[model samples]
Target: MPPAVEARPRDVRGYPVPAITPWEGGEPRFALTDHGRSADCARQRRCSVCDVPMPPGPVWRVVGATESAAIAAALASGEPYRNLAPTTEGPGHRACMLYASMVCPYLARPNARRGSSAERPDELTAHVVRGAVRGELGAVVGFGDFEYAVTETQVLFRFLDLVEYLPHDTADTHLAELRAELGRVR
Candidate 1:
């Protein structure tokens, strides 16, 4: 079971708040990250969504299958996958990440874009955004041993060893197919 909606912290709009969500002058900036909180969660091994200590086990992440496949391809080819592709988001508990995917507007809407192309200035950032497939296709729930690292501008997550993956919506057959393809390559 997931945490009760009311039990989680809320933003001004009464939506369950994520630990990395930023606030500007007391208003939630859903599109932005709070770097300080993000770093704390990473260093302390806490859930990015619930801001609680992660249960002992693999950390979970909600990812786009397209991006997962790309990483898998890069890894198989002996490319520097970690440096070439770092997840801007941090890891969370399985339940927390699942719940956030269902409730967060950006994650819940399949066709929504992160922002204009201008917002994604670099090729890597743009490529990452392309992986944000959601809704009927759902998202990939990845379980892995991960560690935290800080770049000059942001905290990054690197999955040291991927132990498992579960598609968020089993009914989304497309996601299952994609996951299977990723399995073949990874």
Candidate 2:
């Protein structure tokens, strides 16, 4: 079994190297995100975590806490409201999911119960993008400060307005499959 998650997650070196490196596979992908913030981002669209150009179509990303405020408020107030959903990050790769799920506190910690929030949701949410998303993508929180915390360091995004949302049920279910894939990697 994979080791249990610690109270705090630590970075593992040499992680997320693509199974096939550019040397072996061909060119590394790089492109500007549809909502990228900087010219630099436009020139180089890489996973902030692994610095890889995310492959096209079907990647996951979580909406920032601020954007989820409505969801939280609704959950807290017990009122039904428009679901403020987590959206996909602009074009990026998902190769880092296993390592990320292992070490990222924002993700399910090691040994997170199968049914725990670590596992399920109407929408695909990752501390970072790990699967595919469909819906009104909220904001593209690009450049921001990395806030250090006991559990892990987190990046806070500068959010934009609510965008179109894809039907929750219609969202791709790749996250569930990816979660299962972690068992093999671990």
Candidate 3:
């Protein structure tokens, strides 16, 4: 009989590691990453309740295209998103979704002057981009502070919050499937 090959682990940058995930039965278990650990440490230092060591890992969730698009749009629009603040300095709970049912009309509103060119939409675009990044990060890791850029076609989905911590090959495969599914909806 041939021996089964084990899958290797990869870092955030896609470099290979021995194996960050622990194996018990046949499945692998992931702990927190370095960034998560640092955040936990910072939290524990300030909060009286967070005295224990933090687990460095991510929690995964599968979302629909509509939800994903809405989130992407929000990030690109630059609205202020909500996140948790540490009570003292300990790790806080995970972030929850911050949704706005309708798109803000500020960007598409008509200019007052009939003859003049439409009002510049840059301000609204910037606001939406900022807000989306803040909000998405808040929903993922409980608290996040990252800046993002927006584009005309679709929002750039580059926030750490949007990152899935699966193995590199697995993550790539999943992304491919997601892209295909998204293409079908369009």
Candidates in descending TM-score order: 1, 2, 3
**Greater-TM-score candidate between 1 and 2:** 1
Model 2 CA RMSD to the hidden true structure, in angstroms: 14.7
Residue 109 lDDT (model 2): 29
lDDT of every predicted structure (CA atoms): 0.62, 0.31, 0.26
Best lDDT among the predictions, by candidate number: 1
Query: For model 1, how does the per-residue alpha-carbon lDDT over 46-150 read when each residue is reduced to its tens digit?
Result: 888778887667887766546556555655786644433567778886666656665565565566555423243454355435334444344645555677687
TM-score of each: 0.69, 0.29, 0.20
Please list the residue runs of candidate 2 whose C-alpha ends up more than 4 Å from where it truly belongs after superposition. 1-42, 56-59, 63-91, 95-101, 109-176, 179-186
lDDT of 3 by residue, 14-49 (tens): 422221223335443222112233343343421111
TM-score of 1: 0.69
lDDT of 2 at 27: 36
Best by TM-score: 1
- Among residues 3 or more apart in sequence or in different chains, the pairs in candidate 2 whose N, CA or C atoms overlap within 3 Å are 5-110, 54-92, 54-93, 60-129, 60-131, 135-165, 135-166, 136-164, 136-165, 136-166
Error (Å) of candidate 1 at residue 100 is 1.3
